[model samples]
Target: MTTAPVRSRWEEQRSFDELGRPLRDVTFCVVDLETTGGSVGDGDRITEIGAVKVRGGEVIGEFQTLVNPDTAIPAFIAVLTGITNGMVADAPPISSALPAFLEFARGSVLVAHNAGFDVGFLRHFAREQDLPWPDFEVVDTVKLARRVVTRDEAPNHKLSSLARVFRSGTTPNHRALADARATVDVLHGLMERLGSLGVHTLEELQTYSSKVAAAQRRKRHLADRLPHAPGVYLFCDDQSRVLYVGTSKDLRKRVRSYFTASETRSRIGEMVRLASSVTGIECATPLEAEVRELRLIAEHKPSYNRRSRFPEKVTFVKLTREPWPRLSLVKRVLDDDADYLGPFSSRSAAESCLAALHETFPIRQCSDKFGRHPSRSACVLAELGRCLSPCDGSVDSSTYAAVVRQLRDALLRHPDDVVELVNAKMAALAEQERFEEAGVHRDRLASFVRAAARTQRLTSLTRCPEVVATRRDDGGRWCVHVIRHGRLAAAGVIPSGVDARSYVEQLRVSAETVVPSIGPIPAATAEESERILRWLELPGIRLVEVDGEWTCPVRGAGRPHPSTATS
Candidate 1:
């Protein structure tokens, strides 16, 4: 009996591995296009296309096709390319030639002398023709030459100059096939020079040719240990303190990019400079990677992580459980029966929502807690008719409770009442030409509705004790997620032929035991739950099992209120 190969938790066989495919293993389709004009936006059309597919310095195949431009070829263009309208009249149209070219060039890095002109025309044509453009890795021979050959070796990095400098066997002319052939030679020549500089892999060559700073490029070794899988990465300083935290589908590619020009953020550059090492935590799925990143960032509070590090600072608008209930902004949610409407991003946002609630309800605004039988004097808000003055028994407990019930309904069950009230108030203000005051009410109403919607959305998921879902990824594997009380407890992937339901149960058994906590986000941070909710809502996600009813309120703040829809 044959034993299966054991896979490490931190390792997975990826099509594109950590070290990247060596230059010899990379297949390149050196392509050239003869166009009617320089700009696709100027209604340019491809007259001819030529491509030479090469691997390990050997030409495997060649593609050459004349395309009918469907218009008159300019006399100057005809003179340049040695092809006339007559020559292409019998040739295939771009609709045929383009697809054939794409099929031939598929799964190979595209190369061209002036890549912008050649690739741009092809991309524009594909888009205009409603063709799905493949994400092809492109290499420009001119760019490679500019990096490899100096001014002493070549005056300019143009195709003709590089062709002469490299002593290419094929001479570049205006024709597509000949120029494509010459670019192939130029590409190989540049690769040879790059190899001397220790750039043997496709990834290294691309980075070395890019505008990435030398200092940053030297730090590429830090990503060598990372696996090419979905996960979180922590950039730690010499003291082992995490300086930054991030996540990506491919850990090696993402972490390696920080040392390239692609990572342009100034703060991130400084963080990368200070980083002494990188620690990768590979996860089973992208969702798990994201959740892990969030948890780690919150735990470490890495200085370079600008967001998701201070979920504790998120504020919630609460309905205090006092004799005279009032809307108050609080940081944490407890198991108390008092209603809540937040996890708002800021105190000001929660306050604005509270203002909107007070505007619509005659609830007490006093910060002081009142006894059931109060002897204290009423506050200024009571005198202004904004409060029911429960402090002085101006409103009885039952009557005040009824108002609070309506407020809670507006916040949790239905926001129609609040929406109508705020809209009417704003409309009245606008009628008096008080546009600024109307705008203020509008902003307040927006804040209130947004918080209500967000809270309802979160609560819908958190209320469920357990949820197991699966979605088929592009790779034909079932990505399973085990969630408990809104937190991602566990995640895994099931092979195409395996029973997803059985795998889901296995994942559930191994999932983190999350205890239900108070508030909308029961086990995870509001941000983490929100991300999970979004993933759950995406099309094609199948619920394997749900322990409780997973639902949102019909008329709750989850739906857009008509009055605040535009706002």
Candidate 2:
């Protein structure tokens, strides 16, 4: 059996030979319509239709027609359009006129001054006639003029004003045919001006004429080299320093959007302005793209990225490996055989989990390093019956060890004792009408339970030496992932007809080697591990193989605490 060649991590970027339908090869149908009134829904009807189809600066064909409204045309509209009801009384009705006009404009890009008014009427007519409207790409000359011509160049973007400005042979006098002919000249004039700015394709013309900033619109060429596939993209400055990193299901589409008006974020605008180029790494699946984006952001620490740059700064609640074990908040996890319950976002969160553990177990809360033969006095916590008081010799080492064992169980395997103890305290406070204090206990309990749950969820995958999973994506391609100690060791997409199991095994063999580190998330960052766990938990994920235990504790703090649910 011949196996498919393994795809490299970085595929050669596909060249965009033709950005999108070069303008010289495009056929444009410049259309104009005279209506009986302002709105089609207000009983208004089309009075006349005129369109000119042109390609390569030459007129190919023309369509002209007058439609009988079946209703009386208002006197003002008839005067404005110079088409009285008497003129169209013997003409064909819209049902006939619209079909002929649509046939003439078929397979051509539509252009009109104030396209909404003209296209809306046409769309309404099509709907009323139960005719399926062809998805035509429309270009509004009014919007295009706004982007290109300034007030000094043209007092107003009126059809007559622009016709005079562009030196059109025909003048717009509210007549459909003459106005459409005038618009054809104006389109060519605008295209000539845009040609110098590199707007040579139909897509580039559409993007250039949008409400985007000219600086951003000029940079649309940066996306021309990107592929239309799921991947990670980086915006870099002249020095090649990454300005921003992002993931997209379609790299070309997403990168092009940065230059369009839809991207409204101010910092993104600044980033785009400073970016000298765009680099894309095409991935086989969306999951791989997302993971690559996270890893890139962490590696580059791009200035414009607001998250995932400081994974090392995350705090962890550690069960210190000392003569008397106690929970301590630390920044780094070491090779010591002490249990850890976090990867909290803040030190306060780690402290909350530590406080909850101290409240439940009478373990030492002090940070003093104790020798084997310690001779020290207990603090005020001992007097309040809060501490086990091993320092004062009030509690034997064995008895205190038992309490530490239960605390370790709460942090690692079972947290029901912590949950129950905290809930009872909250209930007692609420019964005594001390609701405010109860709220405090409720918050701490919630923090502890959530941290415990997150720790267990990550550890369930991190402890496993290898795990392979697969899921069929919306495109019917199987997305396979090989995870080693909770890190994404390998990922690839298997085509629908191929054997997914065999491909997944091949991926596992070539997977990245990961040496398990010491904490709950041994091989990857907490956020990365969480993302992997979420993908694993998503519906339709089939576990192909597992090298070690891959399960969460049955009675662990993986479930929501009662206090958390209510609060």
Candidate 3:
């Protein structure tokens, strides 16, 4: 019989006090298993098992056997382990092989490079045999290899690298028995290097093994299951509260990526903080996903959703922005009677669009002299012929208003019509061989289309002169609640510098001011469900719908806009 190698008394006396620890007696069994393939779910079989048991950090005994597997060995695996289908054909089944191995490992701690994988594969075989497999507490040398070796030098620390790091001499790798013997040497080196600190109680080692093994399984499972279809996902906290909602064109791709270490930073910090479970619903089409995304954002108010809300109710002049700019009413005359062109969230957006009228286009931007004649004389733009010079009394009211109206039409209602008109004229000119003029029209049309699309519309005004208001202080922000016909929705300014009561008063006053008077020179019709806007020069008292969707109608950062930056 080959006797177990005994360590000298000096090995037992050595202690690594530098690292510090509460060292305890432990048994570590370096084990190996030859398998049909590197998978758990696939019906792969284990062909062999070998283990070297160590106590007091010294090799004590060894166990080795070939498992019958009862299935044809895959050719790749047969070559890899040098255990062909014929070799395993007459081998004893796992039912017979497991008992001897369990007797050898009775009080030892199982260990491997990726120890969990080997143990898991064996546990799977145990389940297949319907045999009560003995529980052998375990440890993983793979995790220790990275800790002991310089990271960059051994980034790919597989079994061989770990064995080489410890100078383990055993060879004939991939076979169960030979590798286990190398693991025994590797364990010895690790114990000497770690001294007392490396020795842990069997229970503590089992706990550590379970944690590492579970983490590895979770990662593998997520990679295997993430889907490719476009959809949305909801992340829930441990208690099942909805922590966040996210949408993806490719659902599986998005969910799987969430597990990567790179994704655990900054904004995704929240995902790491609260993700207890992942649940997903697949959308059949991308468009369906978009609409569903919008609805879910509004409904769940996901902490991660980045978009929301329309611009508030306000007047807009869709002026064409340029080196020499054109300004005019894009949709002025839109009061409660019409859907006003915009509550332009940004001034840059409001001025960059063209007017609606087919002809009589000109720069419509003003120098505070708009709605009034120039006190001194025609402005500089008038001198440049960029303006119609109505401010200087150079243009009559009939002509000036006519020009303003034309500007409004060109900017607001018929942007496409003007584009078509311009294109036709350009084509006509081109046919007549006027390339330069056609080019100008083409460029102008492109500018008009780009500008019009960036705009927002004021759809309605809410007059709740008689309804009630509720107040709430959530964390810090002041949320004003308004109940419209038994349904509750939040309103009011999130105030600063002043109290909530004052903010609520300010909200009431603003809402009343924006909607004063019934039919103040109303427009004929509103387009796209928006009411036509005519001036409410007189406040005759008008019935209005619930409003406040567009502009916050309030000032500063506390004001809410749908597309406002994430908090």
TM-score of 3: 0.33
What tens digits encode model 2's per-residue C-alpha lDDT throughout 1-567? 112243532355443434457788899999999998899888899999999999999999999999998999899998888999899999999999988889899999999999999999999999999888987999888888887889998899998888888999998999899999999999999899888866677876776665577787778789877877788999999999999999998788789878854456888888999999999988777777888888899999999999999888888888888887777888887878878888898888888777888899988888888765667888999999889887877887788889988888888888999899999999999999999999888888888999989989888899999888889888666788888898888888786577766777778778888999786765988888888888999999999999999999888888655776534
lDDT of 1 at 147: 74
- Over 4 Å off in model 2, which ranges? 1-145, 152-211, 371-375, 427-439, 565-567
Q: Is candidate 2 or candidate 3 better by TM-score?
A: 2
Order of quality (TM-score):
1, 2, 3
* lDDT, candidates in the order shown: 0.85, 0.85, 0.52
Structural RMSD, model 3: 20.4
Candidate number that wins on lDDT, 2 or 3: 2
Winner by TM-score: 1
lDDT of 1 by residue, 285-305 (tens): 788888888989999999999
Q: Give the TM-score of candidate 1.
A: 0.85
Please provide the root mean square deviation of candidate 1 (C-alpha atoms, Å). 4.4
Least accurate 10 contiguous residues by lDDT in model 1: 1-10
